[model samples]
Target: MNVAINRKLILNILLFVVMIGVIIFVIRDSLSEIFTELGKTSWPVLLGVTMFGVISQVIEGYTIKNIANEFNREFSIRDGFFASAYATFYRVVTFGTGSIVSEVIYYHKKKLRYSEGTGTSALRMITYKIALMIWALFFLVVKNDAIQRYITNGTFLVIAGIFVTLLIVSVLLILSLNINAQVLLIIFCNRWFKHQKLRDIVDRINNQVYSLRAAIKAFIHDRNAVIRVFCSNMAKLVVWYFLPFFILVQEHPTIDIWLTVALISFTVILGGVLPAPGGIGGFEFVYVLLFRNVVGKVDAVSSLLLYRYATYLLPFLIGMIYVLFNKQRQINHEFKKAKKRS
Candidate 1:
């Protein structure tokens, strides 16, 4: 346990150091410029927009809870949202796999059955990835020529191909599974993470394979829940895209909303794929490269930084607070329960 703590601490320090280095490398003397643009930003709008983002994140957590319900278990809304925020915060702290760790911790703390909690979290992960791929494909094949002006031909082509392939493969696999949740999950887990211990755990809960099937069938057969989740995610993505337009509104009274949306959305999709914490350096680098083609390099960099602050850092701080408070409350609740039992 001591070794684990030391390793985690070391990893966090390294991630922070790397993030700082990336920011320095990208901004250099432009910190002043970044700050200047930041000062010009409308705080009210930023707050409102970020709150909407947070609400969307809460919806994501609720979506997890809905998946859990299929297995006849549940988590409170507050606990679920807190779990989501902390999971995201974990990503920033660990630089990777923090979200997974956070979910596991939250599940145990919430007293959710292990099968139900892990299953719900896994389903949420799969759905989120699929949703992102869906949006990416829509942008790629449909709006390629327009959005490509901001991004490189090479990069656009690569991203588009990936989304298209994922869409095709996912559809084919789901169809082949015929909504057999366990088979799909087993194949997925085995293909990605070949852990003997995980296999053992999965084998223990093999009965829940029927529950998995039920959930998938509900997703396809019922349709409303799936549609609701899809629409909710789409609305969030739209808000995410609109940030660039709002940022530009301060400069130009009339800006092309579609272009701004396309550019920001494309850049964000790229960040989603990159192996970085909250898509930090990877996101900024993509924006710098792409936005420079359409906007000046300086402004492009500024926009990237602004969006990062509005979308990433601000949420990270809020999530940290949420996690801290939630942890205290959770501990207190547990203590009361123990006292009552005693």
Candidate 2:
């Protein structure tokens, strides 16, 4: 167990390094242009971006709170916000499915049962992704020309096919709950793990998965709870774009507000869909590419920088601070608990 934990730690560290390298490489040229443009940005515009960011965070907090409520577990708004902040920080560095490790840690610290916490987190994440995709699809309808040009036909076709496949799989799995997960796991393990020992371990996982199915079914059965969570998550997705629209308005008051909102909405969804951590390179690249055609080069660059600063870098820095603060508090709490037990 200790060896496995150590291996995971090492693997995570390697992934973090790779992700950071990718971020630096992608942002290097863009950062220079963005910084140059930043000098010309008005103080009021920057202030507006900051204020809008804070407001967006409030929406994010409510979404997490609603997700927690879906589990019939009440968590403080501040806790949810900070936990999410911490989760974002970890995910950016890790850049894999294991980006979920932070959520597990946060739930463990909150003293929630592991199954409940993980199930709730998984549900919330799925709902959040769906909300984000819905926002993206809506913007795509409005910004069809821009999307058509930016999203290559081949790429769009591939994404569409993958999305449909995932939808069908999810529906089938949900319908055939228990056996499906096991069969899926077995097939997944057989393809992925070459080692016989690992294959057997995965078979053991299939057996243990029955307990997880029950937990998931219990949570899924709550239709009202799901709707409440979905609505809250959707609201957060809206705010993601709204905040950027506010930033653009502050800078260039003459711009079409609805179009700006639509553009930002599409970019936010793109960021969420992109695999890059914090959507570092992915967001800026897609935003600049699309925005350049819609809004002029100068405005696009400035607007992209301002938007990125408000939405990505600013949150990243804040999450770093929160992670540090949270880790310190956690260490202190653990020490106290240890002392009490002693």
RMSD per candidate (Å) reads 7.8, 6.9
lDDT of 2 by residue, 69-95 (tens): 545466767767766766766665455
- Please give the distance, in angstroms, between residue 45's alpha carbon in candidate 2 and its true position after superposition: 2.2
Error of 2 at 241 (Å): 1.4
Q: How close is candidate 1 to the true structure, as a TM-score?
A: 0.66
Residue-wise C-alpha lDDT for candidate 1, range 1-342, written one tens digit per residue: 555555555555565556556445434453445456667667875665566567666666666665555554555556666667667666766666567656766776777665555555655655666666667667667667765555446455548646754775475435434546556766787787678998887665454444344446545554666666666567656667777777666666666676667666667667545445553576787767666776678767766767766556555556667765654565556555555555
Give the residue spans of candidate 2 off by over 4 A: 1-41, 70-72, 93-98, 149-178, 184-188, 191-193, 196-215, 268-280, 329-342
TM-score of every model versus the real structure: 0.66, 0.70
Residue 227, model 1, lDDT = 69
Candidate 2 similarity to native, TM-score: 0.70
